[model samples]
Target: MCRWLAYTGTPVLLDTVLYKPVHSLIDQSLHSRMGVETTNGDGFGVGWYAPDNGTPAIVREIGPAWSNRNLREIADHVRSPLFFAHIRATTGTPVQQTNCHPFRHGRWMWMHNGGITDFHRIRRELALAVDPELFLDIEGSTDSEMMFYLALTFGLEQDPPGAVARMVGMVERTGHEHGVEFPLQMTVAVTNGQQTWAFRYSSEGASRSLYYSTEVEALRALHPDMAFLREVSDETRLIVSEPLGDLPGAWNEVPESSYGVVGRKGEDDLLPFTPQPV
Candidate 1:
């Protein structure tokens, strides 16, 4: 239902990925070959952490990423060690800035690229499940924002995987009660300025496309003449909804129903993910 990309590693100008890639996020916004829709012109948002310990800065707009001068300007000038960019195609939610992806809460930033099956039917139940304190933070009508708050309510800051699993499980249970099967579908990314966690899961076996960048050294060896490969550190990694380019070995598909972590110390780990009841 949308397209998104996350970068964490050596700091680089946002334009290096958002605009300069062979098939960049901006290109994906206009002619996405792998997304459910070809055009994600509904809206877009970008969130980035500063070089130090601080909350992330977010810029969202209610228009196409391909044509947004503000996005282009920010992409051209903003340099960050980590950032998230998303182009949205609404899945029944209104096309407003508040409903955009990459929803933020203090130090955390989240974005998703799928829908909660029969979300309208279970919206009230899910919303009521959020901690009343976090409920006030709900500013949009999208299921994605609701999912983020739900995760936080379940302890995202302390245990991301567990919290997310509980949130998903709660969603599935709610859907089942409403007579809907396969109640969840999502490719999600969340970060707290130091580490990033990305998940690929759905109640059904099939899910939206999600990929993570291969190590920079591996790409350098695979494409010896590529200059950009030399510019980034070996720890530099990216998680994306689709491959940024056609280069082989540049990206790897995240396994079905699994999650990957990009740690602050530059380590990467992958593990199986299963939802647990709260």
Candidate 2:
């Protein structure tokens, strides 16, 4: 399990979200209150798209984010309208930069906060399912990375939700075939530079915790004296594994088995998500 945050709105320095929050992702790396583990210090990553750049810039490391000077330096300097940050706590996978979250390919970036139940039993079948053309790009040995590639093989670029449904369906089917009772668990985030999609689901009824910010204008009215609210755009939004701080009415839980989209024009939409067989 892990902790992650995705920001989309007006361009803001990365530190605005990564470091300034009272319970920031960096702080969560050492003291996560809701994660399965209290600490997620195995490794970490951040991905962001620069203005006019279709591809994202990714910075990852194989050490604790709390003590990573490089992460702090970059966060203080880089500004982006859309970005992703994750801190990891290994679930059997080795701790390595290549195994970090916010995996990227071309203009797309993906991060996950759950595991493929009994992944080792179904690994070969799932690995074989990835498009051979994309197989060569697999750089890490984590179920989360494989899940991203599986979605890609199922046409993620054109249909993110549909692709993920098919991906989950395959994982569940493979798990059942191997005698696993519940096969999938995930709270995932993906983006293609323009629109961002965040999903919460599991084979079991309950999934991990995921929340998104309430509308900025509403928060402004609730806390008129907060200077930070005035600086960001009305459309400013954040989707996270957990709330960054304790601001009342500032965050809303993403519905179970549903997905949300933050579009290029700053439109927000929530839709039901269900796994479908490929």
Write one digit per residue (lDDT tens) for candidate 1, span 1-278.
99999999989999999999999999999999999999999999999998875699999999999989999899889999999999999999999999997999999999999999989999999999999999998999999999999999999999999999999999999999999989999999999998999999999979899999988888898999999888888889999999999998888999999999997568989999999986
Residue 86 C-alpha lDDT in model 2: 96
- For candidate 1, the lDDT comes to 0.94
lDDT per residue as tens, model 2, 1-278? 89999999989999999999999999999999889999999999999999889999999999999999999999999999999999999999899989998999889999999999889989999999999999999999999999999999999999999999999999999999999999999999999989999999999979999999999999999999999999999888999999999999999999999999997567989999999997
> How far in Å is the alpha carbon of 185 misplaced in model 2?
0.7
Q: How well does candidate 1 match the true structure in TM-score terms? A: 0.99
Off by over 4 Å in 1: none
Misplaced by over 4 Å in model 2 are none
- Provide the overall lDDT of each model, using Cα atoms, as 2-decimal numbers: 0.94, 0.95
The best candidate in terms of lDDT: 2
Q: How accurate locally is residue 260 in candidate 1, as Cα lDDT from 0 to 100? A: 99
- Candidate 1 backbone collisions, by pair: none
- Report residue 15 deviation for candidate 2 (angstroms): 0.6
